[model samples]
Target: MVVVKSVSRHADVASATSELHMESGQIIRYVAPMTLDCAEMNEHQQVVMLAQEKRLLFGDVSEEAEKWAGVSDLCQAMDHIVEIEKETELFKGKRILEVGFCTGLPSVYALEHGAVEATLVCTDNDALNNYIKPTIRKNNVGKLVNYITCDIEQLREKFETNKFDIILAPELVNTKPEYFEQMHDMLKLALAHNGMIFFSGRTHYNSCDGSMSAMLDLMKSKKCFDIMERSTFNNSVRNETAPRKVVQLMHKMC
Candidate 1:
């Protein structure tokens, strides 16, 4: 026999009270929040109780789960950005451009961290206006962000040359080879003379045989940008063991 006590908040707890009799002779009480109905609360409680039993039957893997949770590409990118800010104050009062703004998290982070403004460019307007916009609004940085929906090739027509102080492309280099040419063009047209581009991607995806190397080669051949810093860190998310690399490139001086 197992005994588990579960507490839940509900708008009308008095009316939403329920009891569950498990096969293991466990009595689980569902305390509903003001927002949840009695039936919903009962169903929710069953899930919670089942999870608790599962952890009891099998050892809890919360620590292991947490260790991997912070190992995602997005998490790695955010950590790298934080490191850049600490070393260079890169986002302070800068005009930021974040390419591939799937979640728009980089732009939102920049605005909250001291960036004056950020322009988020992505091909998907639905995600920009729906998911990312709501989060920006919740962060109260809606006024500091501008959204642009277009492919990388259209960047020149969308903005004037030398418009951004820092261009962030988190995990942008892991794309198809054809996009690298367009990315190089965007860098030439959008980045200020002294501006920098900071991007990160998995090591395997950014090295030889990958599009990132090709992109860097293009920039170097053009004599338009110089690699400022490159570093790599290991990540073990989703069973992927490859190290992720972060690179910083600055516009070359004439």
Candidate 2:
């Protein structure tokens, strides 16, 4: 049997850094502050556990979307978000806009943990819409979250400039390489005074082609935000190809 400990509601920032461990045959489930000994659960059940971990809570999705996104990537992404939150004091009772929150697990986690409210944005899809709306209710965070299915840039009408206390994009930034600059501008507009932008992307240590270093250099030139903290983690899925993952917190300058 594998022993998995759940994070307590009273867990301080120091304790938020606890890592989830999975043995070859053991699965760990984090449903809010409760931890399940998943030894008796099967593969499908394990997927359910992972879905909950990926976002605050995952409602039912069509079998196709579930298989398309896969369990390992979703779980790994959530793990990175968890680590990012741990390293900074960004999420408690603050207004947040989580862009491209696939599975909505991180959104729910932020809301339940202390984020006053979260505006969740993702590409509009019938399957995801059906899954996330119910998931928000099922997780009992409906009052704490607003669901939006539109382009991030179009949020100009939905939210005012300097409105959100924190803006988060776990892995979505790198996926939309074409709109990287536009997305950065959207984040800048959505951020409140002294607000934070927490983002993650694949890093290239030596290559100058669109690496995190190049991105940071560009941001420095813009002089819009100050780099508050940064850390790297081993990519769980692309262990060999994309070994290092870069997560950073930027404070919007006054």
Candidate 3:
């Protein structure tokens, strides 16, 4: 049998990533802030337990999304953003635009963490803009992050073209219903020379075949960017699994 020990809510125990023991041939689900005694596992269950460790073990997406509120257990995402900030030299004097500024988490977190030299344009669907805009201002980052509650399709009405140095599009477009044209347009209009665009999405956001194909094709047609780094980030924690394996996109030759 597997011994499961649960912990307090909204807490993550780093040490819990250790190997787990399976109670039966079937899968045993465990969550964060929990302790497991793996000594009583059969060999097969032990194997399964090991596989489980590879996952994030974070809770349900909706629950966590609400509870964590903003950028919780997203240290890795923040780390990547920080790297981009450093490479682009984004600071109080520079400009950065994040396409899907939900909860303004990445924008505010980025500001609170680094890129203090940047003027951030935190844009999102009009519906959610008000929801997170107040939080953005409340973060005391009003001077750094300017909230714009508009779709990427409506950027020109708000700001001039080539006005930003860094563009971030996290969880913006999914594979279905392809937001490629609109995304491409926004990127072209916003980023200036030496500007870098960062996105975290899945390949299916725009196409049935895959999201990467459309993105690659569009970028190639534009001939304005050099694909820098594209990789998969599997941050799946079960019961709270990510929608899909996230595709990380980076560009420089803009």
Candidate 4:
């Protein structure tokens, strides 16, 4: 049994608790919806809640989603990981750095499956810091993980060249669609020879302007990484609002 130390932020915020039962005989605790009334929620929170409620009517979050406290279209991300895992031997005893660690489950999943370590890159938010600390502890894999509260640009500067064996980047397009080329350069400096980068992106009607094919083409044109594998799927469970996501696995061309 894992005990989460109560944090001062949780007491201040209008937070609630939700439980996810995992297949590994563990109970993962996540922040349930905030206790705020509908009228009190910000526009983004309200929009996310409405979409989540719609998805709930179709199906509950999956086992992989349980690892991350039900954030985003994680099941589809896991499906993409599954495809890559079968084709490559990259996880075992390899060093991983994950940018956009929304809940940190992808890192956790990689560690649990035999990766040597996972460094989660994130912004320094009090609530999220409090949340991931316990989530890592709860999995009893805390020793295999590291957290850096900063953007990828700043985080890359602190690491040595060829330091990471695998890099996990999710939701980069939604974060900064214009900066893919710059981001690729920074990540390339930190990746080891033959290192792999797993990047996931999403696009929906009238929401995001780029298609998966276009994004892939742009990566190739940048001339840093060669595509290894690519997968796309409709994420109806976690993303009822934006149902399409693209997952790309790439490695240094040189």
Candidate 5:
């Protein structure tokens, strides 16, 4: 099995406990979402792809997203992310939406790293935002960088189809897969012409599962969507993880 590095983390809520003192540089506590730490952070190095190498060398934040909660091994999945960034037209300077903005890792990284400009409407089910200290520290207490604490299905009213440059569905297999279809419909409404949508999952989530190929085909069948890029990475987090089997995909409205 390949090895991925272990990310450092603490279990007690960083700021909510009220007993812990925060560092001056460290943003105060964040309202972490109720996201499951699905897979352990793989500290081991697998293979670095082109963009992966660049991001790691540059210390890009999205590459570091997997580390905050010990959920992903960015090193193993670098190829997929890099390809999505490079090939997808959806990632640059456009209004973007994040479906599961749990740790704010990828979402903030996307903003900081050029995936989008202006503000991104990030949505999550985390209830910590009301008392979220980091947002205060970041001065997003209630404006600009927005976060919605509602489920994707419930917040359909917040977005208009074809109104955004991009819409992203992160690794949501652990949640309801039906949301993917809804995202597709919403992206059509939310994304501009020639805009893009990125959808991802670890694969085989339900009993009636769809492979990456099947999912892409399904998207095509529904509308004229073009696949800008498709790639796979490793999941060497544990003995049970499939070797070189993680999949990531990017799509555009054709």
Candidate 6:
């Protein structure tokens, strides 16, 4: 059993207790959603509520989400880690580079399991310093993580070539061709030969629109990455607003 200590900026914020049942026979204690109305909650409180809701729906299997409970897409994050672990031992002794705002769950999980080190790249310094850094320290993986606040284009200037064995990009893929092109260049520059990249996001705004197919086409034309594995799962059970299908794309640098 693990209890994630709540770290909130609001002094008057009330903490609600909840239990997350994991498949590994571990239970994590986390803050449940407050009874306050959404209109009354501040921005920070609302973000916390959304995270707690995700943890409840997803069962907090990794004990990573609740520690830094905020604006992370918990469903996709959990699915990405679970699918990767189900297939490979990629985390063992490997260096990880996590791009985009994933709430640092993947990086923390990597260090806890066996990864030598991890670098988390995000444009938000406030989120990195306030939420992610504290959570990393609480999880006792602070020394293994290096947080950087920079745009995706700055990655090449910040690190040497082939710096990461695995690159995690959750909720970074979109329907835009230019977006795909930018991400493809960044992945090729940072990822080592034979390294893997995980790109995951919702299939559409509200319904499946085959946007993933278009994105995959762009990826295939790059020639630098080979599609290794792809899978999709439904998010309708927990999220009724959009309830869209989510896709996970695993690519290996050739």
Clashes of each: 8, 4, 15, 0, 14, 0
Q: Candidates' lDDT values, in order?
A: 0.54, 0.50, 0.45, 0.54, 0.40, 0.52
- Residue 84, model 6: lDDT of 44
Residue-level lDDT of model 6, residues 1-254, one tens digit each, is 11234434442332233333433332233222221121223566545545544555454422333223221333234434555456436578889888743556667666655789998887766556545565566567778888777665566686664478878765554334457777767777787765777655544322123244566677788766667444333334333232222333344533
Judging by TM-score, tell me the better candidate of 2 and 3: 2
Instruction: State in Å the error of residue 167, model 1.
Output: 0.7
Q: Residue 107's C-alpha lDDT in candidate 4?
A: 68
RMSD of each: 13.8, 11.2, 10.9, 8.6, 10.0, 8.8
Write candidate 3's Cα lDDT for 1-254 as tens digits: 23334455442342233332322222222223344453554776545534433342342123222222112222234444345434333333446676642444455545654554334444334424333444554556767666554554465766574477666656444434366766677677677666666665433421233354567677778775676543323323222222322233334432
Q: Looking at model 3, how many pairs of residues clash?
A: 15
lDDT of 1 by residue, 101-164 (tens): 2455566666755899988776765545444566566567878888787654466776674389
> Which regions of candidate 1 are displaced past 4 Å?
1-85, 151-154, 205-210, 230-232, 235-241
List the lowest-lDDT window of 10 residues for candidate 2. 13-22
State the displacement of the C-alpha of residue 130, model 6, in Å, after optimal TM-score superposition: 2.2
C-alpha positional error of residue 10 in candidate 4 after TM-score superposition, expressed in Å: 6.2
Question: lDDT (0-100) at residue 173 of candidate 6?
Answer: 46
* lDDT of candidate 4 over 1-254, digit per residue (tens): 11112233345332445444332332334442222121223656546655554553455433223223223333234434554445435478889887743566566667766789988776857535556665576567888888778666566677654378878766555434576566666677777786777765544223335444556677778776667544333334234454434355556555
What's the ranking of the predictions by lDDT, best on top?
1, 4, 6, 2, 3, 5
Error of 4 at 235 (Å): 6.1
Per-model TM-score versus the true fold: 0.61, 0.59, 0.54, 0.64, 0.53, 0.63
Worst 10 residues of 6 by lDDT: 30-39
lDDT of 5 by residue, 1-254 (tens): 22223333345443332211111111122333222232323443223223333343344524223322222322223323544444433345766565532444344434433554333344422334432335334533233255555555656666643255655545433344455576556655655675556555433322224334455556777764666543343333233221213333344423
Q: What is the lDDT of candidate 5?
A: 0.40
180 Cα displacement, candidate 1 (Å): 0.8
